[model samples]
Target: MKQDSTLVFIPSNLIYKQTGYLKGCKKCFENSEVYYVTSNKPIRNTYQYQCIGFVGETVDFKDSIGNIPLFINSKNGQLSVENNSSITQILYDYDRFKNSDLIHNQSEKYGQHFKYLSEKLKTTREISQNGRNSITKYILFLVQIFDYILKITRRIHQIVQKSSTFAHFEGNITTAKWFLTTLMEERKITPKVGNTICAKIIDLVIGVILTTYLFEYEQQIFDFINFNTEVIISNLRGLLLYLMGQPIGLKLNYSYNNFLGRFFLYHISLWRIFLQGLYPLFTGYFKFLVLPGFLGFSYQIAMISDVVSIATFHSYCIYIYAARLFNLQLKCLKSLWRVLIGRKFNPLRDRVDSCQYSQDQLFIGTLSFTILFFLLPTTMMYYVVFTVFRLITLTVYKCLHIVRNTMQTIPIYLLFLWIVNASSMAGNIHIAWKSFDDRGNVKIEAKLEKLPLLESVKKFIPESESPAKNPRGFGEIFHSILTGTIL
Candidate 1:
């Protein structure tokens, strides 16, 4: 399923005639000598040349020959052939391909007609609401605005890139390399050791500022944190009580549910008392964390956040317990059902195999399956509730880290370069049509090409982690949720 990676050979004169015209003469190269050559050169001019047509390769016949379409089959990644036609153009690489204006006249002619049709379709969708809600429509509007701006910016960038005058600058190789390194990679202005020292200095300054502020209001911050912890504990206790008595209309096994709820409630109470006892130690530790925060690492701040989340450490423990119990019960139910059906799972083969179970074993399996099946709902309810709490905590932590990372990694150097002299940030080289020689050969000249300012800056900046892209993918999480598997 590989394409012929061998080179394609077409007449230079044929392409030259096609290059500078609004519409190329189809038969301009009808009699042109085009050959398909192999890369292997075991023999010289003794090798037979397979003469191809202007657009499609030809087959010799006794009297007449026919033209056949030769194209790459996208699905199979192979060269394919069909009769009577050839692929004149390929609309691949949609984004870059459409952005190009190499065949300007043809593109404009088609573009004008398609523009009206596109507008009509969009208007029709808008009138119909397209099954979109108000929020969806608003979000779509924002997206459209963003896309329009991006498109216009890219178009301008393309124009500048192709223009010979725009990207020309008088600079040495060192300056050029520095510009490219700053724009196309992480902005590294100094040696590695120097960068490390500079980073340490910045961290020290930030740490000092943060430490000064925190120390001044240490009691107040600790008091606020303790008060929030108490409120959270009270709220959690209330929730457990409500769950024990069926807050929702759905009926649950009251005795078992109550037992679980009371156990967690007791755990929470103990955790609160323990936390109160360690208030002084935690306060001192929190103060000490300012030093690491001053070192200006996002992960250091994340570590502090993790320690802060320990206020709900007991809730996390409950979640782990419930998740494990639920998971174990599910496994037990599955195994017992398999046993009842006289089949056992073989780990080595990774398949179920039939087995002859004794009557007593079958009875025991049936009893176990029935018990676990009935208790599953209760276990799941606890697991799901605690998982929600855990997710909320994680979301807050992730947000804080994202904010910190974003602030710390802002491309200030790239921004300054962009402001002072944006053309200096060029990372690409473009070959422009310079002139034609006396022999009618096209002369080309290479020029430095300007990269899109936003795109270049974005490249240099370390992006913050997106909340949607979690440790597990969306499909995995969805499957886990549907199957009642622990997150």
Candidate 2:
């Protein structure tokens, strides 16, 4: 008996195209009765078809959206058979059964993508952090340089106030050179490498020397005006006539006690270092006690002293105020007397000759003015030359090694001074103009209001705006631009 090769079932509502008998088969089977699963709606219907074929033979089935193909047993007409599924079924089964493999592949892909992104993010963050740190350090370094410049400027101002003559300027120049050298050398090895060390040294030295020369030239004019005619005549004539006349005048005026009194007189000099040492101790007390009690008391005292010193220096020459000229003159005369008179025999002559100022005509004509007249010029010249030379050498060194630009070589404090002066002038002008305008406006308004015709006109015309009412001035404009407030 042969089983059916094909089985077709027709439901009650469906039609059949083929209803043939089986041929050349061992068994023939009748078709199973078809049953339709129906819903209340006519469109919802279901049917099933089954066929038997030879074992291990390839079978083809129609591809439909809602169809499932299955193999059947041909001999027993049994529905049970091992199904060789479609590609879609194989993919679905693999996805369902291989859960660990799917998870592993997804995790590996995600991790690689995440690592790549993370590496990029880390690099970006590092660069950003480094840039911020670099900028912060650069700004801090610039601030230190600025502070140093301020300190140097203050020192320069102090030096200038101390000695008006060019000769004393040398000490200041030497100090400036040494300071700059130390600063540049330290900068080269420290937190910031100075880019213009050579240029700065060169420019500063040159500027100082030129300034000193100018100051000395002016000082010579000042000295010439102050010196007496006799001193000038003696210096111009180059004569020793003034030295011989001193002894006769001293013998005419001297008493024994007066002669002996000059020898025993003590010379006292004030030491600046003592005051400097006191400054630190006073500063601590100032910070802890004095400052809190009265704000800026110590600072005001310093400022007052500075002002007084400046006033004194401007009013009287440094040598006169310091008494150094008198001391130097006395020393010079004493040396001259020791050379001329024998040490034991002419004791009275030695005492009279050792006086800084001579009483006799010869000494008065030749060397009496030495204390004020000759010394001032010599001191001024010496200071001018020394300072100029020191400055020049320092400048050359700086030009060769450090400074690169003209602007960088200029002292920053000078520029600040210029700016301050200009600003002060501008402020004065602004204030003056504002005051004038405000006062004028009141008069104008009163007149306008009082006059009957003008008052009627004022009803139609707007009141004139005063200068005080005007918007920002030049200073405000400059400030706004500098602070980036009005961009």
Candidate 3:
């Protein structure tokens, strides 16, 4: 009872139609090759009249020819793996889950941005109105100095990424790898940690040199600062004067408008005096004052930015006052309108509910609504103007910080490691064709290989967070305009 040596091909649908039976017949054999599973005992010369192979789920195959579980093509030299539908379905479901996670992460990022904006708004208002005491001033100075150092360190990385020398070094990395591989293996030194340590050292040296250069030209920086400050004060004076009149072709409350405009102008006069008093101090040892023992030039530039922010504190104060008034009036008008409609908002239920109002309540609501409606245009105009000014300031700083972060966080060191020793950061291996059979048939062998440099780089560099969030998006701004909410 030796097993048959012949292996044959047959359509899976034909075998399935037999209901798990091994029957040899003209109908089953027509246009199909006879197939049988066999043990390697001997080849058969006579055709077996009955089917000779296991049938049904045990010998599973696709219903179609193109999707056969295993096949060899003379035209192509590829070996395709079994394509199970269940596995494909599982992959599809996983992709769908990842898509949902992407959306959830986006919303979470938006919330974080909104929170950041709100905090900045509150801090700006506080600084503008209450003014910074000596302790607060020192604290602000220390924080800004630390931020400057961080930015400079990031800038060093930027310099490295842009260097022609580094690019050339990357080109000869293959040679370097061959020379250093033996030593590196003996020392158990991996490229990942080596790249990081080298990058840090480079950044430190370059940052120190750059800061020293900037310090040497301190006088020129002070001159530029003085010129910019003068120009800003002059432009601000003109802007205040323009706002005091009917500047934008719209009729505003003349008395209130002029009062706010003149008050800020006087405040600006006081600021000019305050700045002049501190001018000599900045030109002298302001660096030491800002960062007790450190004398970095980036700190000076940051201190200059802080000074500009202080110079515009009066405008922020005006924005706060106008925005608050506009928001308060809008809220009052909304409540009164609800009362007129015989509805009130239930905070607990988070929805509007029917309500009954007395005659006095109705009268007061109506009167208040009418007054707020009339006064809205004046408050809105002030709020819009100040908001524009506030946005301009925010945009400038936003751009500056974006540059700093880009310099700081880009995976240049990992990328450099990828260039020099890609295997050090490799995460996985893939199979690739290694050789062909001597018979010149469609048969081949594959060898396992590490991921390529680009793919390995992805494994080493962690995924970055979403882009920088804005204080308000265009849709939110548009909605606020329609609803009369504070922007």
Candidate 4:
């Protein structure tokens, strides 16, 4: 008898790793060939005796609709040669295939609530004993250290202000702005609050200060006590331009408030997030490959890069907000389009709430990794080396903050401390929870429900059979109900 039919396997372990599947396959396909196709290589099933890894894409799978093929691949294995004429080819590309595995695993294991894959599973005992060994704790720890140093910086400002014509700005927020003037004056850069030329000079001074914090500074070497204690902030374009070593412009986002304009706006933010994520990886690669540096500056540069990582974290937070904003804007535009076209559309009026999103929680979750990465890829570090690396990281972080809030009257340190405390308190009380779910999909508990907020975040942390129907995003509960859909 000649081999007659095929059973196509996805680039997933669930298909191959199940016990007795190969034996079942062997018995069923005794004559027919079983094709194991994938783009990326799969890890061998160590449990099985005849396990083999599948690497690279094989024959591309084409879908035949209307005409049912001899075989149709289902999530559960139920296809055979007798029931079907041919096996349906499920072509697996490298990126799409791996992502499929991630989604499948998360859904299979976690079901409804999707969490970060890299996040270690914590037991109740572990949670009680060590707390969540999450990046949030590391961020909180590093942030506390910076908070203390901010107090010192405020004292320095107080003393410095006494001697200069600059009066003490009262609010905690003004400490940073006031400090910028002090820094400019100290550098002989000439602070002119009333003069346009002076304003440009101040920006020049700030720019130099920003570059010094970002690149290298003399004080960074000597100021061991004031480690990672510089303040800094940069607009998206400026940071990209400096890091990439070329002047680049933003993708033209035209907002005409018309049909075309709204459509473009709806799509723009989603693409923007991908671009932002790529930039950090780009900077990381560029530093390691293109920008060669001495081993001496290795740790120092690594420390500075901590701020870069944190900035990336901040950008991710912004991306989340952008996503939320786009969701609302898109829904309205879609509604308008339906109305204009005289389509049956239900206006959801009950669940309307102010568009409020949290930027801090996302930062909190990523902060741990930002600090952790500054220490390098070492899993085990000597105690002394770890302490020193931490100190270096703190120094760099502090420096960025100091530069960013240079002209502020209020101490940025205290403000940061407040945010941390607020985030922690609110989160524990169910006000501002941060589950740090895979990508941007966040399912909150109390605070969100009390306020009756909608989860506008979509296509993030996708689950296979999500109870929250539309993984692309089930809009506000009210909207779902109005549409007679329970997403």
Candidate 5:
């Protein structure tokens, strides 16, 4: 199947009954042909019929599709898999299961765009409808079972305390807030770790691993990419400057050269396959890594926080998380946002039209141009600088016997960093803000409250009234302080 057209296995009898079916059918199809799969002939004249097959529960196909199972359900009228959700629907529901490999690959490989997902499903379907084995079938079965078990537990808990957040008031922001708070409080304790220690441990492990691995080989990684790609990076920058109307003979400043030199050297594609792939792989987990660190580090503060502190911290966390998501969405919305916000009615319309618009464009274009020329040389350079700086300082201290041993030095610094972070310096530079954000709300303090009046007041207060200030230039953008709806 070269995908000359769409492959539809519509019910044979209804093909001729064109109830905008043709429209949905035609738009998707690359070619005019529609393959029909049915057990019986059409009741009326068929538009196109190429395949004949019976789709039932115990039956399997010979076509070599991907290992994932696909089945047609006559009962629900869904193209489903293993009696779960519809195949088409699940494929459409990106990130429903964040841990899923298929979902992860969708973002990394295909940018998780609708067109890409749709095309992928179409191609995979037409490629081959190979029958999967009992092994895959069993694994899916277990997943479904676990999902069912979780759902049942949640449902049971819902009965004890109402599932609805604001049970009386249908749906609103207040209701949503209450419900979410309830959910977090309801199951505050879990089997393995009390106080969400698992999240903390994970953060510690990842931080240690990142620090050690990156610190040790930082120079090596830098040099390897730099020495090999220097000429190409230089020549490429010169070319870019020329294209931008800058003379080729113009002397480049250290800043300009540094910026260009780092771009290509940071790229993963130029490296051995395994290494390059790791960058995005690491990036995609940015939130995961960050959240754990923030939550874990600030965990104790949360337990002791007063009404205002608690409300602010929780609300801020949600805001930051949501902002992070918004940022991610913004990345995807580039060209799309330009057209959308260009509309006068759009919320960000003014921001879109401002003089900063060109600056933003230039910034994006420059960054893209850098990436286009070379992968991530700038990123690697920054990382190596940090690593070297930390290592050199530690080395000097140790050589002077001021820092006696690795165990004493590292732990002492780490603890000092923790204290500094917990003391609110974390809210400044270096993602210690993440740790600070995790300080739990003491207002709730393991108690479930129906009306968090104080929290509500805390939520609505103007930013100017709040004494807290973030030095980070982009803090306002990332730190969300929702006005109301505190629970």
Candidate 6:
């Protein structure tokens, strides 16, 4: 019988070990049979075997070689044998067949692994986008809340100002007390009510709490915007330092005033004694009459002193409050500027560099105007104080003419008044300067533009015009009414 050609098929497994033999197998044999080999290597487990054709005819040497059939039968009840027709061709085919199952299996496994990884990456991206959207929504909500609070405060201020009569004051105080008591009750704290003084104390307490909440809310909004705790903390420290410096400067001015007042009193007392000794000799026992005149003169001086003191105190208080308000305004402006420009701490350079047209002129114009406003007002006030001091000195000399006997003592009253006014002025100036340094004007400008009613008011009143001066007495009165306690 004619021998049939051997055929071979290489399994994927063991492909790497048989690259040279694979080339030989394709060249030497037209058709050859092949079988894949298994190994203990972990990587080889996913591979499988393949057969191209029959290897050879079955060979049964009963006692010796027939054990192959038995071995196959023992394992899986199947016969396993190679053809014998083309022995030489079959041997070559078997030697040259390449195993490729390992490469195929590895490719499929990695493809699945990459597919899972891609899915996870897409999911992560979606979660991040959602978080960003939520943050944006939260910021918008905070801005709305801020707007509402501003409107409420403005309305309250107007109402308080319009109703200034004693009855109105008492009514407001009563309302404040009720509001505070209700708030306390809501918090499960016992409520207390008393006279005007007590009410003011409560008002102060409530105001402080409200202020704290406002600050906390602002901080949260800031955190959302920046999203870095260290940056937020640094900015907060700057704000706190600016605030702390205000009271220190105020106290220093107060101390200076007291020293001046004491110096004036000492000189004045000496002058009085000297004048009394001189007066008796001028009109024989008229010195006794001069005592009564001295007493009346002292009363007039006391009244003048009281008026000056009260006015100075009121002015100083207003200045301090205005300074504080200005500081807060500047901080807000800085925040807004950062939002608009997409940069922080480079207001001048960044803003200016971005300017492309005349529309951008507004920033420079506003900055120039602010600087002028602050400098002009401060300069005018300084000159005015200087003129006032000159006039007071002239008045003191005129008073000395009538009471030449007490000429030495008149300087004491003048000095006391001068000291009080000077101290108060110094304190106010310090506060205003600090506030300006803190960039308050920028904030106020931003707020005025943002707020609806405020913007309307600004339209009617030019930007050059200042707001009505706040009453100094109102702080103490309001504090007492709100908190129900006296300081």
All candidates: TM-score: 0.55, 0.18, 0.52, 0.16, 0.16, 0.14
- Candidate 2 wrongly placed segments (more than 4 Å): 1-141, 144-301, 311-325, 340-487
lDDT digits (tens) for residues 119-168 of candidate 3: 32223221222433554565456556545654554567455333322222
Which wins on TM-score, candidate 5 or candidate 6?
5
Candidate order, lDDT descending: 1, 3, 4, 5, 6, 2
lDDT (CA) per prediction: 0.51, 0.29, 0.48, 0.32, 0.31, 0.31
Record all residue pairs in model 1 with backbone atoms less than 3 Å apart, i.e. clashing: 207-294
Please estimate how well model 5 matches the true structure, expressed as its whole-model Cα lDDT. Answer: 0.31
lDDT of 4 by residue, 353-440 (tens): 3332345633543454353333221111111222333334444544543432333212233233234432211111122333433333
| Per-candidate RMSD, Å | 20.6, 37.6, 20.3, 31.0, 30.1, 35.4
Q: Where does candidate 5 stray beyond 4 Å?
A: 1-3, 7-53, 56-197, 200-468, 474-487
Which segments of candidate 6 are over 4 A away from where they belong? Answer: 1-159, 162-350, 354-487
Better of 2 and 3 by lDDT: 3
For model 6, residues 278-345, the per-residue Cα lDDT tens digits are 44453354333223222233222322333233323322332333344344444545544543553445
For model 1, give the 10-residue run with minimal summed lDDT.
17-26
lDDT of 2 by residue, 72-175 (tens): 23343222212321111100111111111011112341233222322322222212344655665665676566567656755676554443221122323443
Q: How accurate is candidate 3 locally (lDDT)?
A: 0.48
* Candidate 2 overall lDDT versus native: 0.29
Error of 2 at 5 (Å): 98
- TM for candidate 6 is 0.14
